[model samples]
Target: MPVRHPAPTPPFNIIRMSHIELGVTNLDASRKFYTEILGLIETEQVGNSIYLRGLEERNHHSFVLTKVERPHVIRLGFKVASEADLDSMATYFGTKGMATGWVTQHGQGRSLQMRDPFGMPLEFCYEFAQAERMLQQYGAYRGCHPQRIDHFNCFTPNVQASHDFWALELGFRTTEYTVSEDADPQLWAIWMHRKGNIHDMAFTNGAGPRLHHVALWVPTAMHIIHLCDLMSTTGYLDNMERGPGRHGISNAFFLYVRDPDGHRIEIYTSDYLTVDPDLEPIEWQLRDPQRQTLWGAPAPKSWFEEGSLLAGANVQPPVLQAQPIIAS
Candidate 1:
């Protein structure tokens, strides 16, 4: 188990898990999938990149796809409380002996880029150009009608270390966790949040710094079911990888699908709120079947074995290397 420390008052403020920059091999193919099939609104296209956002999102974009030969998670983005928080973040990373740099992003203001202790690429920004929201634009709705960017799930080599840093240093609260049932158990996975939802981010015990999936919040379970039917008829049936099932952990109704670049995306809904400061994290044993899926078959090997590579980082196998039960 990871050692516990009193959660610190962070010097900087983070408002929410904001956006993501996903690198794809073929921008055109990815644009079609994310825009047409996933129902993400295409905001802009510049050179080799495409900018997109969900229907209800007012920000310029929550997702960006850039052309790259290797498909990888380019960077994760967060909304900070103020522009001064950028300097505070840089100082925080510097004190930890980690380097941070400022990068100018189109449609967004000043941003700081750095890698976490586990080397997950991250960015923090405060100002983003607002876009016209299409929430009530009934005629424009298509695919699953993604409402907004939800959360990110990452596979990490050292789950405990990752958990501690985010909880103690960055002030994230754990909403749920799983423990390996070894003689002396260890933290096998954790769901931590800055925003009031169940998770802004989750770290699962696995090989280092890989993206498990980027979840998009859809309106209802019917949206997910609609996606399944649409995919079956539109030659995207094979992209439907997992579920139309519920997770015991978050009680979230979900369906996992693969994009043109093999990056996993989860269409998610039906999770409950977790805003209470004293709310206890739901715990699950590593071998518990229900924790992985409240119903339906176990997740297949591909779901367990495959994930998008992180940009500019090398992979490291987990220290414990404990495997969870998967579909046989």
Candidate 2:
């Protein structure tokens, strides 16, 4: 039997999602789409790389794009409350016999990179170069006007295993979850959070270790409409894939758009607060189609079958195989 590490006594303080690095084929076009179209502020451009932050963000960046031959997700970054948490996490994963390493990227503190029980590239670090907040610069806002990266939704073959590992070892709390109905209720998806909002990261049963979407928080549902108008008038209507609808699980209004490199980005808002540690996680049945989208249009097939492959050490990791839950 595999040994389980008890949740940290002091609980490693995972502040929130700090930033995400993505590999893009065209830096200039991607830069234009993210800055001019999506309305994220570009902090700096270093050769083939560009750094971006949201309107209300004080950090140097919440998202990054680097020119590559193809678009792919590089890493999922998280912020820890203290530097000590990095050491604790390193030791914690080390004791679990996981592959671990330290990476020192420019303008950022040392980051700990590791693959979770299931294979996914994850980085946790404490500090980064801070930037001036553009919250009051209302005139500078354009396009979709996203505020900050709200959360990441990932594809995993086994939601229950990943959810258990994240909740039991990393101290993430489940705010909501889905289970297939019938005689045996099998876990289908879960929304887990470290921050006060609904979720910092979520796992849905699918092909393993793929990123379904990265969500950028908008202030209201109207902003989601604004994105639709922006894309519609700008000749990128096809990029708009799904939503402007509410999710029954998180109660968040959402819109999904495909980036220049086919990476799915979600413009999201309006999830309820999950600050109470003792709060019970809301459960939904998989048979209820409305659970996925409260407004009642079934999710498109691409939403279920497609996702970006995880970037492994040398090549993409082979998808970890598992059976999907059947809703009876």
Identify the candidate with maximal TM-score.
1
How many clashing residue pairs are found in candidate 2?
A: 0
lDDT of 2 at 304: 76
Task: Report model 1's TM-score to 2 decimal places.
Answer: 0.97
Candidate 2: lDDT of 233? 91
Those runs of model 1 whose alpha carbons end farther than 4 Å from true positions after fitting are 3-6
Question: Which window of 10 residues has the lowest lDDT sum in candidate 2?
Answer: 1-10
| Model 2, span 1-328: residue lDDT tens | 1112223334478988778999999888898889989999999988888999999998888898988877789999999999999998888777878878999875578899988877689999898888889999999898778899999999887777887788777887778888766465777788888888998999887767788999899988998898899998997899988877898889899999999889999999988988875677788877577787886666777887778877873323223332332222
**What local distance difference test score does each model get?**
0.90, 0.82
